[model samples]
Target: MSTPQNLKLPIPDVLASAICAANRLIQRLAQPWLVQLVLRLAIAVPFWKSGILKWHGFLQLSDTAIDLFTQEFQLHLPGGPYPFPAPAVVAFLSACGEVTFPVLLVLGFGTRFAAAGLILMTCIIELTVPDGWPIHLTWVAMALAIAAWGPGRVSIDYLLGDRNARW
Candidate 1:
């Protein structure tokens, strides 16, 4: 039996060179800044859409939003599926966070803060809709990645000379 590290496959020189060139091209196209921008947009769009639906006008919560929280949503605790405390307040706060955090993420301003907020929101959402864990887990993963990576270059955080900004 050969050790994994000791096993190697021979390749034609032309094939090797082509592979190297393709890798270089891919690396050039997939810059960290671009990847971060895409991640930001991907996570932001869903929340933004949901937030928009919750509002009828500026600062005005839709009846549907309030109704969902009051009648439909519940916290799936160990003992019971509990109704949300102060359902109106919870709905308003959720709507506000869903809108505000995503905008901050897209702008890459206070990126870590925005990501953290999203993570918190996702957890709450998971508790409210336990069956939606698959989607919530994706949101948490993206938020965690953004928080860990911070805003890459080409972001407002980078433009403002944040010391921790990724290059």
Candidate 2:
């Protein structure tokens, strides 16, 4: 088969050279460790802040949290002795997971598991609060990227010699 001429595009020589230079620059500067560190911090903050709030709520046994769970976040349990258990329990568990997993992620210990947990939590949140999919989806994407790509070089995962390897 002959090469398709249509595939070729006409461009200014300066623009093409600039694009090539940019690509090379990116190749040089885009280190895995730096990117992963950023991703780790970026994803961790939201979970960390939220987890702290939940932990505080758990400590205080906040009425607002209970109300939020009972009215807004009450997950419907299927076919059980009790129709629904205490919302506080669910909130507490979620808070623990959020706090623990994100810390693990930030530390790069159990990085994949932490990212996976966050991903699951993101899914649950997405399902529960469908209206907030845009924000949640971004979280999901970041989690998946971290989960799949690993925590990068500056992480415990790297020091533990599990950067390129999957759990």
Candidate 3:
């Protein structure tokens, strides 16, 4: 058999192959675990900050916190001229929710449940603060993404085999 000639690829073909390889490399670099970790952190930060602010005075109620719940976040009932007042209770519950759920999310324990709670919290905030829908929608989208995609393999839930627990 005659010796085979060395085959040479065209310059454009080589460039195209390089580009394709780079595209695949980028896609591989965007690992699901890393993405989930980012999502968890991104969505958790705001809630954690809000929670920390609200719970600054753990045992005692701060006047500023009270004022926000009473004045800014009051729920008006149609029944009476006076409202069904539970500002302190609502504020405490909300603060607890924000803190607890975000911690769970960041830890990747019960991520889906945490995301759902955040979604509910977002809904309440939207209803109460309609003007802030844009911000709330962003929060909702992040939470929804977590809820939909789950915590991935980097999570405690994955270790515990609960990563698929979207409820």
User: Model 1 over residues 80-144: C-alpha lDDT tens digits?
Assistant: 89999999999999999999999999999998899999999999999999999999999999888
Model 3 lDDT per residue over 19-109, tens place: 9999999899888788888989998999998888875565665677778887766443355233226988877878888899989998999
Clashes of each: 0, 0, 0
Model 2, which residues run further than 4 Å from truth? 1-11, 57-61, 74-84, 165-167
Tens digit per residue, CA lDDT, model 2, 21-66: 9999998888777777888889999988877776443355456655
Which window of ten consecutive residues has the lowest lDDT sum in model 3? 75-84
Off by over 4 Å in 3: 1-22, 74-84, 163-167
The C-alpha TM-scores of every prediction are 0.86, 0.77, 0.78
TM-score of candidate 2 on Cα atoms, chains taken together: 0.77
lDDT score for candidate 2 against the true structure:
0.78
Candidate 3: residue pairs that collide = none
Clashes of 1: 0
Off by over 4 Å in 1: 1-18, 165-167
